[model samples]
Each structure stands twice: as structure tokens, then as C-alpha cells.
Target chain A: MKRYMPLFVLPTLCAFILGFILPFIMGVGLSFCKFTTVTDAKFVGFSNYIKALQDTVFRHSFWYTALFTVVSLLVINVIAFALAMALTQKMRGTNIFRTIFFMPNLIGGIVLGYIWQLIFNGILAKYSTALALNEWYGFWGLIILVSWQQIGYMMIIYIAGLQAIPGDVLEAAQIDGATGWQRLWKVTVPMMMPSITICSFLSVTNGFKLFDQNLSLTAGEPGKMSEMMALNIYNTFYGRTGWEGVGQAKAVLFFILVVIIGVLQLRATRSKEVQQ
Target chain B: MKKKKVMPVLLAAAMTVGMFAGCGSNDAGTAGGSTQGAQGTQAADKSSGDGSVYYLNFKPEADEQWQILASEYTKETGVPVTVLTAASGEYEKTLKSEMAKTDAPTLFQVNGPVGLASWKDYCYDLSGADVTGQLTSEDFALKDGDQTLGIGYVIESYGIIYNKALLEKAGYTAADITNFASLKKVAEDITARKDELGFSAFTSAGMDGSSDWRFKTHLANLPIYYEYKADGIDNTDAIKGTYLDNYRQIWDLYINNATCDPKLLSTKTGDDAVAEFATEEAVFYQNGTWAYNDVKDLGDDNLGLLPIYIGVDGEENQGICTGTENYWCVNKNAAPEDIQATLDFMNWCVTSETGVNAMCKDMGFVIPFKSNLDSENVLVNAANDYLDAGKTPVTWNFTTMPSEEWKNGVGSALTAYAADQSDANWDAVKKAFVEGWATEAAAAK
Candidate 1:
């Protein structure tokens, strides 16, 4: 088996290098150059980066995305955890409830954005306003949209973690005269740290990389005040001529920021995991 | 146990080999299929003595007509012509990605000089081409120094399209409203009697993406046109919005007299406006000749075109806005035979009887070529009447707009102002129009 490792690994290695690694490297290189098409690139060094940073819209989107990620991460994880706890208590018809809750996750982001747009506009029309008229409306609209789509998925992960808890451990806590809340906090939560780490990491990263929902919901309307980082980069790349290099630079910076944040979050959460 | 171990190993080895075979066969299959396809086309081209044509069309509304025309041309001439239309509002993005392909478009279009700037290197000079000779006027040809980079194919006119029957019921004729002052008086009168008359003065000035271009680009063009006329310039890097107040009055008229609440305009669509006019729920609709198909059910005699009167000084002699954003250009990088074929096809499109009929009648386009046939479209005939009367048609200077981003900024400002109707919001619209233009223009440089 050991000797056959090279043969087994070669196919996947080739695909990874060709599909992901090469384009990623080329993208980073192009960030420092200005060109419409890849064949016509001319190196301009830090100018692209300077232009990206100088853009007030880009800066606004960065802060907007940061707040969105933090708020969404907390909301999604807390509600999903609570739902998982309730559903795992030998409740009747839990499967039906779980399926119903998870159905929204199966819908496409663009579709969800449009459906919710109609619903939100229909309600807001009573007030004689629209979602695109104000930035805060767009912000809260996206938050609600994303939370609806992602909460079900996170709940499934939490459910899996809950079901995996050893029965004997809870029995031991009970024998020690532990109450339900105490058993949950001391024994179950400590034991569930591994799952918590994985769930948090996924939710945090997903919150930052969100684009389709943000785009279809508001499209950075009311003068681009609702744009997030990913959508901002996309608009820069496609919407503005002579700004492709700046868009590429923004993408590279976005990648680095997401990576650093993801790493720090993993480290913080992984340290809390206790051995079974 | 040894047999089981060997069987599992054999299965694993087979699975890996199958994966390799799958990858290898896909590459080989595509390579062979494409080469075969290329050879087949080459053989057909050789037999026909002409290269194939691939036209990347810009208009989605005329896509079906283009497809039929292409098939007919191919049948008659034995030259393969493929037509692909980009989705509405996605032409530039589609063009950029398509131009990067190996089998890029042989024939394409640019909006105007600003659009031609990015694709200048890709454009084949049409100065001495047969299609260039067919153009009715040099004004329709986009030039760069000595080279004719593109030729305007369709001439479209946009203004306040009104229902003649509805206007008569409101006790006014088309002649009674020749300028802004009279137009305003009539519209205000209609609005005052809207409840009794069972129709409003104008359709909803929708601010949704589908309808906002009517205001942001077409309506916005009025101010730019007046400024350009004052400066005696065709294009400008920075705009002095001299006629913005006129723009404000026209916008105010449209929203205040409309069939819907101003606050709900952002949710309305182009379809809504057209429906309002077609169903006779409104007296006026701000759109172009292309909207004829949507509202033609009201009968030809009931329709008329009125020049958008925005209270400009010259006023009475102003015709409807008549210009084009669609300009055809052959790709310079195509094979020489393909380039020649594209040029020949373009000339045939403008010169041939079948082509002219298809364009003018079927597509309802007022083509800008010498062989252009008479249009049956009522709105088009109305436009020609304006031109015949020697009214100064406002040229489309909106083509020189810096970018789509600038339009969006102004559009949002306009929508916000529509919702609030405040001075500060109107000031924001002015800032977006003037300052955003300057910023975008400098960035484009």
C-alpha cells in the first residue's frame, strides 16, 4: 500500500496544481500589473494597490463586511446550537422539523435573494419606502437573508455533534447530582468543543466569503453604500474599465485577510477542545 | 483471506486506472471533435469560396430577427453565419469575455466613441469598405483620425410618446404642445382632471433597473445635449450641467402627474410604464420607437411622438432626440478572409432587398443606410415628420458618459430624490451628475 502511494496521489496532485495553484499564482502576479486582458499586462507595481486603498467605497465595504460577518456568525451559531439542543431531546417529529428547517438551505442564493426582496418590498411598501432607498435597510435585509439560508446548515452540524455525545458521560454527570444546565455546560459543552471549533470556523469563513446573497439582495444600491468586500471586488473587476488591476489587488488583499482571520479563529477555538 | 486481499487490491488498481482513462479520453475526445469540426467548416468554406461569419449582436429584442436573417443569408449564399445576442445590459461584459476566445466574433458592435476606446485595437478600419459607402451621412460613422472605426446601423428616437385619443379627450392636440411651457400647461391640466378623465398625465417613472435607464440615460441626455450645444463640442471630459433645471422640471412633471406614488417608483419596471400607456391608463410615456411593438395594439393612428420639452430656451423648434448607440465594427484580428466575409455580409445586410425589409419592417429599425426601406412603425414616421419640419434633433451625447457606475450614482440620487422630493436630495443628484462625471472621466483616462 505504501509503495503504491505515488500512483494514487499523482492524479489528484496534477488536478490541484493545474486547476487551483497555477491560476492563483497568476492572479497574484496580475495584481501588480495593469491590463484589460491577461496577454496585454504591463507591470505597474504598487499603483494598483494604492488605487484600491484610496477608493472610499472599497474601505466602506471592508468595514461593512466585517460587521456583517461578526453579527451573522454570532446569530447563526447561537440559534443553531439552541435548535440542536431542543431537537436532540428525543422530541417527536424531529426529522420532519429538521427537514423543513433545512429546506431553505437547498435553495439557490440568487433565488432566495429575489424571493426575499419581493417579500421585504411588499412589507416596506406599507411604509411607502423600498429596500434600495437606504443602506441600513439593505444591510439588515442581507443579514436576515444570510441568517435564514445558513442557520439550517449550522443546525445540522450541531445536531450531529449532539448525537455523538457518549451516553455514559451524561449518566456519570447525573450520578454526581448535576442539574440539566450544569450537565450541559460542564460535560456536554466541553465534550462538544471539537464540533464547536469546526462549526465556528465554517460559519466565520462563510460569512466573509458571501457574495451572491449580498449581490442579489441590494447590489450595493442607494449609491453602493451596501456593498460588501466580495461584491466590491467583483464590481471593480467587471464594471469599471482600466480598473482591472485594482480589482485583482483587492481580491488578493481579501484572500489574505480571510486567511488570517480564519487561522486566528481556528487557533482560538481549537485550544478549548478537551480530549475524550 | 489472500484471495480477498488480492481482490480488494485489484479493485483499487482498476479504479485508479479508470480515473486516468476518464481524464485521458475526455481530452482526446474534445481535441478530436474540435479538429473534426474545424476541418468540416474549412471544407465547407473552401467549397463556398468565402469565410464564415460570427456576429455578436447587442440587442436582445431583435435577436429572433437576426437569427432568421442569418439563416436566410446562409441558405442563399452558402456562407455560414452564426448570430449570438448578449442579454440586455450585459453586452460590454459579454464582449470582453468573448473577445478573449480563440473563435472570437468576426462582427461586433460598440456603443460609441467611449465604447470604441477599449476596442480600438480590435476594430478593422472600414474607411474604404462597401458598408461605409452605404452610410447616409458621415455623422453616423464613428471616426478616429482617418479611420472609420464603426458605422451606426440603427437610428432610434426617444421622447414623450402620447396617446392621441387620450390627449384629444383632454382637449389638446399635438400641435398645441410644441414646447415646454405648453407641454407643462397641458400635463398639469390633465393631472388636475386625472380623476374625472380616468387617466393620469404620464406613466410611472419607474426607478427599477429595468426602467431607470429612461431617466438616467435618456432623460439625462437632455442636459448633456444642451450643454454640448452651448459649448459646441461633441464630447467633453467634464460636464457643466447648464440645463439641469430643465431636466428637473421634466422629471418633476413625469413623477408628479404619474399614475403611481413617487415613493413606489423604485419598484416599478419598464413593463409597468409600457402597460400603463398601452392600456390607456396614462396619456404619455417616455420611451423610444422600439417600444412600438408593446403599445401598437392601440392602433397606429392613435399614437404620436412629442419632443421631450424640458423648458430649454430654444424650445419650440426642438425635435425628438434622434441618435444611436449601436455601431457595427468588424474585428481586425479575424482571419483576412473572415474579415472580408464579415464586411461583405454587412454590405449585403444594408443593400439587399430582403435584408432591408427584414431590418426596416420586421425588426422595426430605422436604419441609417441609403438603401433603407420605409418603416411602417408609427413612432418612426412621427420621428421622420419632426426631421422633415427642420427641428433640431438632439444628438445622443449620453454615449460619451464616463461609465455605467456614473449612471448608477445619478440614478440612485434621482430615486432618492423621487422618494423624498427635497432640495438636499436634488443637490445630491446634481453632485452625482457633475462631480461623479468628472471623477469617472478622469479615472477612464
Candidate 2:
């Protein structure tokens, strides 16, 4: 079994190289050139990256995306944990309620975005203004949308982690005369580190990578003040002239940021994992 | 603890499997190719009899007529004709991507100078061709010295389209207004009696891509006085601060005296503006000459279209905003046979009886051609009389080569103006207009 590790990893290795590594390499190489079509590209280095970094819109979008991700991570995890706590008990229709709550996650991001746009706008229309009228409306609108989409998924993870705790731990805590709050804060939560880590990682990464919903929801309206980082990178690459390399650089930076944060988080949470 | 780790890993594996399963096919690249069949694939697979013509038309109004011709061509020559129309204002972006495909539309529009530069690499010239004789003016030809890249199928005009009944109710006739003062006075009077007249002076002057042309092109033309003076002789660039103050005279009246709020109008969609104009809710529409056909169908004979007499120093010398509303340019990257087939179809449209008559009915008028349009085509003929009277038309500054970023930059500036009705915003528009031209000019370098 130990000797078959190479064979076991072969499929994933090939898929990763083909789908991610090759495209990334090609994208990086192409960033130095300027051409409408890939075959016709002409070398125009550093200029593209310089233009992108200097672009005021790209800078603004970076800040916007950072703010949105921080806010969304907090909201999604808190709600998911609460739901997971409620669902862990022996409740009626628990299975059905869990499935129902998870259904939104099954819907495609683009479809969900358009549907919510209709709902939000239909309500906002009475005021004779649109979601794009103000940046605050756009920010809160995206927060609500992302939270609604991701909460159930994180909840399921939290539930699984909660159930994995040993029954003896609770019994031992009761025998020690510990309160419910104290056990929840110490034993249960510390034991649940792995699940909390996974959920946090997903929510953070998803917040950073959000694209389709942002695109369909506002399309960076109110004069592009509400454009997020991913959408900003996309617009910069395609929308502006001589900015493709810069968008690519920004993407590279984004990858580094997410990786660093994810690694730090996993390290912090895994340190708290019990010796079970 | 072992179950906790194993179950989450299994779920992750399940999701990964599900994703790959959804995209099981190896050739996802080919999925983008199935649309608008290869430009000349039919021609290559078979003879000219089987050679299809794929025209990606920019003008939406010509769809019905093109449909008739496409069916007729297929019936007559056994070659299929597919005409695809872009939704209004999305033509440039559509053209760029559509031209990139392996089976992209064989025949696509390269309408003007901006289009000529952006698309010239992909455009095959039409110099000294049979279709060249069909144009009313050789001026419609978009060329880079010798490379005649595009020409007009139908030359359209633009100015003030108005409701004749609404004018009469305001105690005026078409004869009563021939210049800017009278037009402004009539608008003021009509606006004063808005409660009685059931409408205001002008329609909503939205500064979105849809209605900004009324300011950027038509109304802006009044100050330049149609002499093509914006950039001077051979200085092909957008109009800067040359006569921006003069442009403001009518623009102020347009937004302030209009029926709707400026901010509300800023947020209004194109459909709302067109609908309000069509329902006879307003007396005047600052639009192109192509509107005659749609306005006629509103079931009202009282609606009349004319050029605005907005104040110009030399008023009598000015006529309607006359030029090619759009142009037809063949794709240079196209297969030689398909390009020939497209040219054949184009020639047939201008020369053949059925094609000319069909275009006349569809486009609301016909261009000056050897085939000659039926005399009964009144809306277009009325527009032609303005050109025939020798009143110089608005020099469509469209022929000036703009950087590819020009349109988006202009759109952004115009959108800003719509949001905040301030002179500072107007100055930003001017800067974008001028600087954007210089930037694009530099890029094309």
C-alpha cells in the first residue's frame, strides 16, 4: 500500500497539471504579449503589469473585495455554527430540514444571483431606485446573497464535527460538575477544531473567489464603485487596454494571499485539536 | 476521530467526482464553435449553389427585410443566408468576439472610421467594385488611403422627430418653425401648458449610451455648424472645448425643461425612453432618421420627423444630421469563396429588383442606386429631400479613428454626467473626449 502511493496520486496529479498548472503557465506567458487572438500576440512586457498596478479601479476593487470577504466570513460562520448547534439535537424532521437548508447551495451561482437580483430589485423598485444607486446597498446586498448561499454548507460541516465528539467526554464533564457553557467553550469547541478549520477555509476562499454572483447582481454599477476583486481583475484583463499583465499579476497576488491566510488558519486551528 | 477525518475527505472526493462527471467530455473547446455556423463552411463543403452567406448585421431595423432576402436567396440560389442582428448598442463588442471564431460570420459590418481601424486587419477592401457604384456618396467609403474597407447599404439621417398633432395643439405648424429660436420658443410654450397638453417639451434626456448621442453627436453639431470643424482639416479627433458652451444651450433646455427628473432619467432604461416617445407623450424626439418606420407603425399619421433648428451661427446652411447610419464591410479573414459569395449577395441586394424593394420597405428608404426605389417610399424620400436641398449634413465625427478604449471611456463619462448634472462632470466628459482620442491615437501608433 505504501509503495502504491505514486499510482494512487497519478490521476489527481495529471488533472491538476492539465487543468490548473498548464493554463496558469500559459496565462503568465501570455501576459507579456499584446494581441487580440492568442496566436497573434506581440511581446509588450512590464507595461501591462505597470498599467494594472497604476489603474485606480483595480486598487479600489482590491479594497472592496477585502472588506466583503472579511464581513462575509464572520456572518457565514456564525450563522452556520448556530444552525449546526440546533440541528445536532434529536429534533423532528431534522433530516428534511437539513436537506432543505442545503438546497440553495445546489443552485448555480449565476442562477441564484439573477433570482436574488429580481427579489432585491422588486422590493427596491417601490422606492424608485435600484440596487446600483448606492455603494452601501450593493455591499449589503452581496453580503446577504453570499451568506444565504454558503451558511447551510458550513452548517453541515459543523454538525458532522459536533456529532464526532465522544459521549464519554460529556459524561465525564457532568461527573466533574462542569456547567453546559464551560463544556461547550472548552471540550466541545476544541474537539471541533478540524471542522471549524475546514468551514473557515472554505468561507474565506469562497469570499475571495466570488465572481458570477457579483457579475450578475450589480455588474459593478454606481460607476464601478462596488466592483469586487475577482470582477475587477476580469474587467481589467478584458475591459482595459494594456492591462492584461497587471490583471495576471493581481491574480498571482490573490493566490499568495489566500494560500498564506489558509495555511496560517489551519496551523492555528490544528494546534487546538485534542489528542483523541 | 477517525470517522470525522474520513467522512469529510469522502465528501470532498464526492464533490470533485461530481464536478468532473458534469464535464465528462474531453473537447470543451468545441462547445463555443457550434453557434452561427462556420462563416463559409457550407461553401467549402459544397458548390456556390451550396455556399451560404452569413451576415452579422448591426442594424436591428433591417432584420425583417434581411429575413425576406435570406429566404429569397436560399430559394433562388440554393445557398443558405443567415442574418444575425446584435441587440442595440452591443454591436462593437459582439463584432470583436464573433470575428475571432473558426466559423465566425463570413460577412460582418465595419461601419465607420473607428470600425475601420479596429477591424481593418480583418476587412477586405471594396474599391472599384460593382457595389461601389450603388452608394449615393463615395464619402461613405471607409478607407485607409487606398484600402476602401466599408460602404453604406442605406444612408440614414437624424435630427428632431416630432408629433405634428402636438405641434398644432401648441399653435404652431411645421412652417412656423424653421430655425433654432422658433423651435426653442415652441418648446417653451408647449412646456408652459404641460397640464393642458398632457405632455412636456422634450422626452427624457437620459445620458446613458442610448440617448447621449443626442448631445455627443446631433445637438453638439449645432455649434460646429456642420463644417466638420471639430478637429480642423485632417485633424481627425473628437470635438473638445471648441464650442462646448453652445452645445450647453440646447442641452440645458433638454434636461431641465424635460418631463422627468434628471436623476430618474439617469437611471431610466432605453426601452422606457423609446416607449414614452412612441406613445405621443412628448412632442419632440432627438433621434436618427431610421425612426420613421417604427413611428409610422404606432398607428398615428400625425407624427412627423424633421431636423432641429437649434441655434447655429449659419442656420440656413444646416440640414438634417445626414450620413450613413451604419455601413457594411466584408470580413477580410473570411474564406475567399465565402467573401465572394457575400459580395455577390450584397451586389444582388443593391442591383436586383426584389432585393432593392425589400431593403426600401425594411430600411424605411432606399439609397441612391441604379435599381431605383419605388416612388411611394415617402418617409425615406422626405429625408432625402433635406440632403437634396443642399443643406450640409452633420459631419459624423465617427470616421475619426478612436482608440479601442474610446467608446467605454465616453460611456463612463456620459454616465457620470447623467448621475451628477454639473459643469465639472461636463469638463470630465470633455477631458475623456479629448484625452481618450489622444490616448487611442497613441495606442494605434
User: Per-candidate TM-score, first chain only?
Assistant: 0.97, 0.92
| Candidate 1 chain A lDDT trough over 10 residues, lowest sum | A3-12
Write one digit per residue (lDDT tens) for candidate 2, span B1-445: 7666676567657766765875464321122222332121222224544355778767666656666677787777776677766655556655655665665667777657755655667778889778877776767677788878887666666777777887788789877777777777888888889998898878887654456556655565455443345445534544454655556566766766677765555445555567777887888877765665557655446756576665667766667766664678887777777788888888888888788878776555556566756544344555567778887666665545354355555555655665566999878766766677676666554
Q: Is the docking of candidate 1 incorrect, acceptable, medium or high quality?
A: medium
Q: Point out the worst 10-residue segment of candidate 2 chain A by lDDT.
A: A236-245
Q: After superposition, how far is residue A160 of candidate 2 from its true place, in Å?
A: 5.1
Error of 1 at B50 (Å): 4.6
Model 1, runs deviating above 4 Å: A1-11, B1-50
> Interface-residue RMSD per candidate?
2.8, 6.2
Q: Which candidate has the highest TM-score of all?
A: 1
Assess every candidate by TM-score: 0.93, 0.79
Fnat for the candidates in order: 0.45, 0.07
